[model samples]
Target: MTCNLAYNPRFMFLTKTIRYNLLAILACLLWSSSFVTTKHALDYQTPLTLAGLRFVLAGLIQIPLCGHLLAPLRMLRKEFFTVLLVSIFHTIFLYGTFFIGMTWVGGAEGAIMIGVGPLSSALMAHLFMHDDKMQRRTLVSIGFGMAGVVLISLASKPWSPVGLKEFFGLMLLLSGAVVSALGNVVVAKRKGGLHPIALNSAQMLLGGVVLLLIAFPFEGAANFALPPAFYGQLMWLAVISATAFAIWFHLLSKIKVSKLNLWKFLIPLSGATLSWLLLPDESPTLPSLAGMALIVAGIVIGQRESK
Candidate 1:
């Protein structure tokens, strides 16, 4: 019995490491591919409804697996308000606007905008968070990063051919980027160590509920009923989101938060690469590639400096 019990932990540790890496890779792929999936879904839905439904559905799936953690809901009393605020930042300010902006923004462009997250997050950390501090090197890297984005935008077909609509869309997406960065900083600095799974579950559930409320008045549910043909796609969206969060939180639990943050730089690049593979005709423009390069350079420099 003693020998068997000892062997059990070794087996479990190996299993967990393998599972964690697999899930991390999957999370990246699923999240990157979300740009394409969102594009497909938009054909049959409005951005608001789509955003709301996606989170709500994802939360529903999570509830069953994570129901036990719900008992600790009361434990989060002091931080409950903080969690709610972050939930809004994610569901409304981040993803809500992101969905709407994606209507106007191509996958590649969306990827580039998303890359702004690391830089924005770093800035927020410097200003507001306790753990991270600012430095000259980071500032310089951020400048290069912004320059890259500016060049990409200028080189594009047109920044705003459709008047304020396109302009507003861009603004909204960028705002989402900033808010997302802020949320990351908050999570990093907040007191106490949360079980990543429980924390993630709570955030998603709260965010999804808020999204439903916002989307309901807009009648987002009306777009959800689809024929058998599209059911596969819906399943895909749900699986991708659920699996991504699970893996993401698991990784967060294992690694140092600062090191994990550096990995976010890959998101935009991966999104663009996947978008190119999935939708050949909608390939990234030369300028977008330039932006990708800058984003990468900025992240490397910024992380190096911060360290």
Candidate 2:
């Protein structure tokens, strides 16, 4: 005799995969638009203060939303300090430098430098972390990525006898990349994942405190008036922080981390496109477009071989 049993359909898994990738792309677009928003917001607020507020608000929003997922205080004791350290280095130091650098550099140049994140992350994985071993194809992919970086940097025109101030700006952004690389390695191969929401929230809180403390010393206290449009801008930034991170971390849970990373190639390309649309003076020249093509190609090759 035949018996019937309740079973979930296999297609559910396929549907989920599609949903995750869709969310990932949405996260990318939201994050890309941040470059433009930050540029606009800088007219009213100092970079450090703005960075501080962004994280503070993000943390506040996440606390009530994810508080239940955190481990008990005793269980978190050992990890508590480590999380704070990573937050300071990765979120505060890295973001602080990037914002300060933005004061001197355009969104286009910043996007190109930030686009090298995946390669930097890969190198960090190979050097410091276990279980994220570099494969031969990954190395080949890295070569392509490096070539793209060279082209993008050349297209950015950093050293055409500009003032020393411009060079310092580049240095700050490059430093931000190094810090972000370190964060990636620190996260790679971590056993028994922390609740992403809890972790991100705590770190953002700590980082915000640090950044805010630094803000006043650098920018001084200004009773600056806000334009009517700043409310819209701030709301956009808040949405970028909350929504992008929620979607990104959710995807990380559902998919292999390495596979999800491939979408990073789209970030700078999107940012470049946004800049082209927004800025009258700047557009993607042929070299910039070629650089983006190389980045995308490298990501595809890397993902195929990473398996």
Candidate 3:
């Protein structure tokens, strides 16, 4: 018994690490699915309007399921602004650019572009976190990841030199990713200052409201008289957002932001693969595969210890 207990700490550490990684992977997987779903939904709805509906519905679903809604409300008084800032970047800007950018690129390209997020997250985590520093491996990974992104951009138009439109779109998509990293840093700083459900629900609600306001003025109204496919996509997106954001907030509080984000490497892999399978117009191309390989390699490198 004594000998068994002696190694218990190591076992516990390994268990905890595995659990966290699994949770991170789960969240990233849900996120990766959005590219395909959003693509289908976009056919029936305007960009910002669809985004608004997804988040608002997500928030509505999450808040009720939270069991005690008042608890989140109570918690919000102290952490209101923190959650607000998160909503601005995480929900509004992230989805805003995501919708617009997808118009210019296919689902796979959009997902790969979003995959560039962890590179930015690594840098931001170093700036904001005491435990996460920019190491040689991190630097090396960034170089590789940038190369991957460039390759992906070149491949965006599929076997042709990417024109200014695709380049601009990719940049817009990447900007959302950068702000999203900042948002993750914000959530990490809190370290569970708010309940994950509460925080996610609040941000989604607030962000959804603002998006609807913006959409009405600029993008115009959305038609609810639509096909089952559109509604199905919207429902799935909302479900995933509610579930994934809750998981993400929980993970952000518990794990090192940089280390946890290493799992995001799965996003590009899963997203692109799914896109190729689902989206009619999308298929594997040399530059895209090569770019994904480099990005995955960078993520592998990023996972290494500083030495």
**Candidate closest to the true structure, highest TM-score:** 3
Ranking of models by lDDT: 3, 2, 1
Error of 1 at 230 (Å): 3.7
Q: Please give the lDDT score at residue 157 for candidate 1.
A: 37
Residue-level lDDT of model 3, residues 82-102, one tens digit each, is: 878999989999998888888
Q: Estimate candidate 1's alpha-carbon lDDT, on a 0 to 1 scale.
A: 0.65
Q: Write the per-residue lDDT of candidate 2 for residues 1-307, one digit (tens) a residue.
A: 6533334455665566668777888988888889878888888888998888888777667766775635323223657775776686668989899889989875446665676666676666667755566677776776776677567656655545546786788788888877777765554434347666666677777787788889888777633478878767867786687677656655655554444655676777676677678778776778977987887787668656232
lDDT for 146 in candidate 1 is 65
Residue 5 C-alpha lDDT in model 3: 48
Give the per-residue lDDT digits (tens) of candidate 1, residues 75-155: 246468766765776566798898888787654355557657657766776777555675677667666666665555455
The clash count of every prediction, one per candidate, is 0, 0, 0
TM-score for each prediction? 0.75, 0.81, 0.86
Model 1 superposed RMSD (Cα): 5.7
True lDDT of residue 108, candidate 3: 41
lDDT of each: 0.65, 0.70, 0.81
The alpha-carbon root-mean-square deviation between model 3 and the true structure, to one decimal in Å, is 2.9
